[model samples]
Structures are given as C-alpha cells and as structure tokens.
Target: MRLSRPLRALVVVDGTDLHHDLLGASSALRDIVLEGGVVADRAVGADRFVDPLPVTAEADVYVLYRSSTHLAPEQQAALSAAVAAGKGLVVLHSSNLFGFEEGGIDADQVAYELVGSRYVSHGDAGSEGTYTVRVRGGHPVTAHMADFVIEDEYYVIECRDDVTVLADRTTPEGGTQPIVYVREHGEGRVVYVALGHDMRAWGSPHFRQVVRQAVLWAGGVGLDAVASWSTRFPLGNGRFIGPDGGAPA
Candidate 1:
C-alpha cells in the first residue's frame, strides 16, 4: 500500500470552519493526487487525545486547525514519534488554542511539555482590518509578488523561550507576536500559522500560498506541485510524495 505512493497525511481541525473544509467536496478531489494524511476538525476537545488523534503512521503529514496545541501524553508521543521518524505537521487557526495551564489533563501535561509556552493574558489586537502578508524570505511559496492583504485575526499567544517565530505582527502596545512559526521538536517539524479565524482571509492568493507552502514544505514537497496537488487533496492535511519522492512510507 505504501509503495503505491509514498507518504500518508492527516489534517485535524478542532473548530467548525476547519471541519467544514476538510470534509467538504473540494478536499476529496485533492486527496486523489497528493495522498498523504488528513485530520482537520472544527470542534473543541475538552481533553487531550492519547492515541493518534488524526489517523496513524499511515499519515506522515498533519494539518491541524482550531484545536488545542497541547497533546495528551499518548497523542504527543505518537505525533512526536512520527515526526522524529520523519513526519510533517501543518497547523492553522489555533494550534495555540491549548489551555493546558488552566485545565490539566494527560494531554495537557504532554502539551505543556511539548509547547513549553504558558498563556498568561489576552488583549484585543484591535483589528488591524485587512493587512498585507509579506514574505520575510525568498521561499517559492510566497515569492510570487510581494505582499497581499487579508482579513485576519492577530492573536496574542504566550510563548516559551525555545519558540522560534517566522513572522509576527506589531501589537498596538508596541510588541511583536508571531503569526507563523515553525519549530523542530525531536525529529518532527511543527509549522503553525495563526491565520484562518476569518474565513474571508482564505481569499487572498498569498493566504492560500502560505497554507499550501507550509503544508507542502512540512511533507517535503515543492512549489511546482502546489497547483496540481491543491485540487487533488483539498480536504487534507493530506500528503503525496508527488513526482519528487518522500520517505519510503
């Protein structure tokens, strides 16, 4: 089964919108080509999960949405192990929604240890309205034009010392917070983007690119594959080795 393609992916969402997208019509068609993993949910989990929340090793890539970032010990161990074994992760909306500090559980313990960030307080970002998404680097995904605007929510996340931020927004109070971040824990890579609270924001070309880029990059695919794969695996946090080549699955 593995040889038929290469990688398996699961996109998990823990809110309403994310679930709608993952289980929608567009996503099924998209999965035909890319063929990875998927677990995009739009619900709120009262507690962390212990097993593979999305699927299993069958999925090498994960696209998380609107769920708590903290993982149950079992869940964290599984995901971390997958990545350490060479899996990929792509997060949207609230990979940071975890409230482990407030509600302690097995998953909370795993999450607290994994994320290492504690939530202290939250204040309004004061709605910057629709702003431009600028690429800080020359990655092909975002190299298209320059910057594009989208109606998005700028969240205030409490972070840890080891958190590596990719891009951030200027807070009204004169501080910067990362809207997108990627970190390597053990062997797996965590790519989290704080966008998608506003559904309309997905309209921007750059917005889609950011998501597509993060997904493909995590699974180790390239830009040229985006257009084709986008259609083939719309509902995914899905994966396919593409024409290139990923792990042996």
Candidate 2:
C-alpha cells in the first residue's frame, strides 16, 4: 500500500550558537514542507541530543541546522550511518560551521564530507546587504525557483568539486559564491543551502519554496512529479493531495 504521509524529516538545531532561533527555524521548515511530516529536535551541546538522534526509525531526511563547531563522535557516526543507509541529508546555513574550525578540520568531518561545503565566514550579521541569488540550472530543487533578492547574511563557502551547483550569489567583490548545491553520497542524497541567516529568510516566500522543493528532492521525490500532482489536484493552497483527493495524514 502507498504511504499515507509523503515522508518523515528530522530538523536538528543542535548548536545554533544562539545566533538564530532554533525553534523558530525548525517550525518554519515544518510549515514549508508540510507534505512531508517533520520533527524538530535540539542538542544541548556537542554531546547531548534533546531528541536522541534516532537510530532504527530514522526519518527519510535529516536536516542539520546547528551552528556548533563540533558534534559528539557518536552523533556524527549515527548521521554517517543514516546516510549510508540511503537516507537524505540536508545541511542549512550555520551547519556548515560544523567543521573547518579555528585551527583546522577539527570537527565533524563526516558531516563536512556529506555536506560538501565549509563555512568560511559571512559579510555581516545584520540586514545590511542584499543578496541577488540566482538558480544555476534546471535541477529538481531549483526547477520552479527564479532569481531573488534577500536581505540576509551572505556566506562565503569553500565548496567541493563534484557537487552539482544549484544556485549562486555574486558578491560585491566580483566573486561568485555558491548559495545552494546537491550531490549524491553513498546511496543517499545531500543538499546544502547557505541562505538562512535568520527570520528574514525563513519568512520569505521564495526561500520557503526553495526549501520545500529541496526537502522533497532530498527525500528522493521529484518536483516535476509534485508539480504534476498539484496541477491535477488544484488545491490553490500549495499543499499535497493524495490521488484519492484527500490530504495525507
């Protein structure tokens, strides 16, 4: 039988550095991707997970929104195992700071490897500059998204060679920085978006849409399939309706 719900996603805001509201960000993600149920969790520090990262009943997608410089070795291992088992991994803004610390790669190497991007730094903390983000190509996640201007922290990331570039933002210094990307890992997928700095991004329709599509794509669902389904259902509300013409539980 087909599953009633689209898929399960776990949002982890383990270590935010208190730069952003972890709860609020998680809630925003939940609202953005309601088609796939989401459960938000946090970790007190590098060693303590409030929700105790699931092992057996792992969700289809795991979102790392933490800003911590480190994660417990066990926690890192658990995430690695999940991805190896073919579960999707989503890395958000500050999560890129998980490694490449002050001295060297002194943090969660597993997460860094999975995400394929390292957070070098950002311009500023306040709403000073506007970032003109552009979609790189016709990828499933960026299929329906267009160039958008957002007032948020513009990140400078050190990206990998093999990752597929999904979006980019050109800095004022005449350098282009990747804002979004995706790549395959083991038997799973990985997505990284460097836009979410605070509520400004979370509240934007464009950001929300990109996040929604990324979640579905990470979970191994295609936006084309979702778009086709939405067209047939004609909800007017951007939501999912099972072929039976009822919302999935």
Candidate 3:
C-alpha cells in the first residue's frame, strides 16, 4: 500500500505557543500542500491527540510543524504506524527542535528516528539575512530548484548518516549545513526541511517550490508532474504571524 503522488496529507500543529503563532503556520501549510495538489487535512493544536488517531491512519502523508516536544507513547506509536503503513511524512523546521522535553521518552531520539534528523542548535533568532542556498545534487526533492540567496532564519540541521542530502545552506559563520533531505523508513518516505522558521522562508517562491516538490516526491508521486506543476502555478500567499503579535493582512 505504498502511497502515490498527490495523496491526502494531514498536518498536526502545536498551538500552545502563542509566540510561534502555529495557527498561522497551520493555515499556511494547508494552503501550500493543497496548492501542490495534495488533499490536505488540518489538525490544529491539541486535536492531534485524538483517540485512535483516525486522521493520520486515513491519510497518505503526515506533516508536523510545531515546537511541542512532548508526545505520549500512544501518540508516538500512531505516527510510527502511519509510516509503517507506507505513508509519507514531511518534517518542517520547528519539528526538528525538541526543547526541554518533559516526557520520559527521549524526544530528540524520537525526532531523529522519525524525521532522520533533529535540531541541535541554531544562530540568532530574528536574524534574517541573505545566505547561499544550493542544491547539493540531483535528488528528486531538490529538483527544479537552483542555488539562490534568501532572507530567513538559517538552521543548522543534524541528520542521520543514511539520510539523503538534498540541499544545503551556508551559515553566517561560513559553515554549510544540510537544509533539506529525505529518508526511507520501512515502506514509507520522509522528507525534512530545516528552513522555514518564519514567514519569509514560507513565502519565498523558491522555498515554496522546493517544499511542494518535496511533499509530492515524499508521497511517492513521480517528479515529472511536480516539475510541470511547478512551472505552471505560483505559490499560495500563506500568512506569516510575526513576533510583533500582529497577524498579516
């Protein structure tokens, strides 16, 4: 039952953090995944802990973009089960950051195993600047994207050894780190992106293209259609809630 391209996707976001404005992120992700032609189901805040995890089980792909490091065993197993059932997974920026986990389970270990990486550290916050982002090689997820300069939060990703590196970003300190990658787990596929810490990255045309292609590719959709779609359609205007606490108009 391998998931094919343009499959249904379920997004689980952590809504507890008022500062992160995960609600805006959730809305943006829904639109973005939909724009890529995938059926997107929005699961905001605590709804992700629904009993039996019906939404995840029914979907072909699971997307997580939140900062909540706490996951009950049942919640963790549900996601694992989805992947084992041959579904796809797309892990975004904050999903890799497991800070001060409260549960007995090692949150960092769980993230790495599920997403093929975890965020160990990062540069200054709100420090947006132009950086060199390059397509490392000929990976399907990085296809149709080129090396360009973007202004956003640059993350330093620490991924597993076997994960396929797709693209990289040069840090302000002259160090290069993996920004995008994918890995295969059991019968499922996983794509992780360390970019998109804020609205700028989410709104960037190039960033959206890379993420759209990654979502499709991770879902087992052939790249030919995604590449063609990339050329025909522009990215959705996903809203980004800034740190100033004002929502975008």
Better lDDT candidate (2, 3): 3
Provide the clashing-pair count of each candidate structure. Answer: 38, 0, 1
Give Cα-based local distance difference scores for all models.
0.51, 0.68, 0.69
User: Where does the lowest 10-residue lDDT sum fall in candidate 2?
Assistant: 229-238
Give candidate 3's TM-score: 0.82
TM-score of structure candidate 2: 0.80
| Order of candidate numbers by TM-score, starting with the best | 3, 2, 1
lDDT of 2 at 132: 83
* lDDT top scorer: 3
Pick by TM-score: 2 or 3, better one: 3
lDDT of 1 by residue, 1-249 (tens): 122235555545443443335343234313322332323323233223334444443565666554334444566665555666677776665555555544654445555445444333344656435554544654433333244456776567776667666666666687776666666667666676766654465554445556656666677665555444442223243433233222122
Ordering by lDDT: 3, 2, 1
Listed in order, each prediction's TM-score against the native is 0.65, 0.80, 0.82
Strongest candidate by TM-score: 3
What digit string (tens of lDDT, one per residue) describes model 2 on residues 137-173? 4677776455778877878888878799888987777
**Which segments of model 1 are wrong by more than 4 Å?**
1-7, 15-55, 68-71, 100-109, 112-122, 126-128, 139-145, 222-249
List model 3 lDDT by residue over 1-249, tens digit each. 122433888877863565466877788878777777778888865345445367766777777887775655566666666676688888888776553566432744554577787666667543456786777646667765667667766576567788988888766667778878888888999998877767777787667767777778777887666544542234333332122232332
